[model samples]
Target: MVDVGTTLEMVQASQAGMSALGAGLAVGLTGIGAGIAEMAIGSAAVGATAENRDVFGLVLLLTVIPETIVIFGLVVALLLLF
Candidate 1:
């Protein structure tokens, strides 16, 4: 096997690859968390709607709260890629 520290370029390339992998993992984990959060939010919205239609506006806002996390992850990943 080639030595990982054989050259400066090799070291830099390895670091870049690791950084990309980390970014991917971060995004995946964040997305999963967001999905789980949304599941509860959706159920609550449905329940709220069943009892009172007036809750729709509030539910809409609350339900989308988890999405902001995913958006943040996307922003960070994009910054890393560029």
Candidate 2:
């Protein structure tokens, strides 16, 4: 009983929904990945800083490196949505 136009519209709507889902997944997974990386890096940074005061700056820089991954993911998701 479905007409061609209705079927086409339904397919288009489904595609858009899937695209949104993919964007959400991309951002979510990247955030999780960043968190995991930061967890291990933070522990090491603390240990290094405890041992040597001068290394605190280096450790801080290293700890923030993983943040870029999440930023990139956000950009990708935005691109997908727009």
Candidate 3:
């Protein structure tokens, strides 16, 4: 007893839901990945900085590298949303 319009609407709604979920997963997974990467990098940076103050700049750069993962995730999520 379902009409074509109703079926089409249902499909569209499902597609939208899936897109949202995909976007969320993208951001969430990338955040987790970034966190994991940062954990190791941060510890190494701290140790290096502790050894010599002169290397603090280098260590800081290394520590910030993992942040790009989250930035990429945010971009992907935005693209999905719009």
Name the candidate that leads on lDDT. 2
In candidate 2 the C-alpha lDDT for residue 29 amounts to 93
Error of 3 at 42 (Å): 0.6
For 1-82, candidate 2 gives per-residue lDDT tens digits of 4456677778878878888998898899999999999999999999999999999999999998999998998898888888
Off-target runs (Cα >4 Å) in candidate 3 are 1-6
Q: Can you write out model 3's per-residue Cα lDDT over 1-82, one digit (the tens) per residue?
A: 4456677778877878888998999899999998899999999899988889999998889988988998899899889888
List CA RMSD, all candidates: 2.5, 3.1, 3.1
lDDT of 2: 0.89
| Candidate 2 wrongly placed segments (more than 4 Å) | 1-6
Query: How well is each residue in 1-82 modelled by candidate 1, as lDDT tens digits?
Result: 3585488888778778877987897689899999999999999899999999999999999998999999888888777767
Clashes of each: 0, 0, 0
Model 2, C-alpha of 41: deviation from truth (Å) = 1.0
Clashing pairs in 3: none
Cα-based lDDT for every prediction: 0.87, 0.89, 0.88
Shift of residue 65 alpha carbon in model 1, Å: 0.3
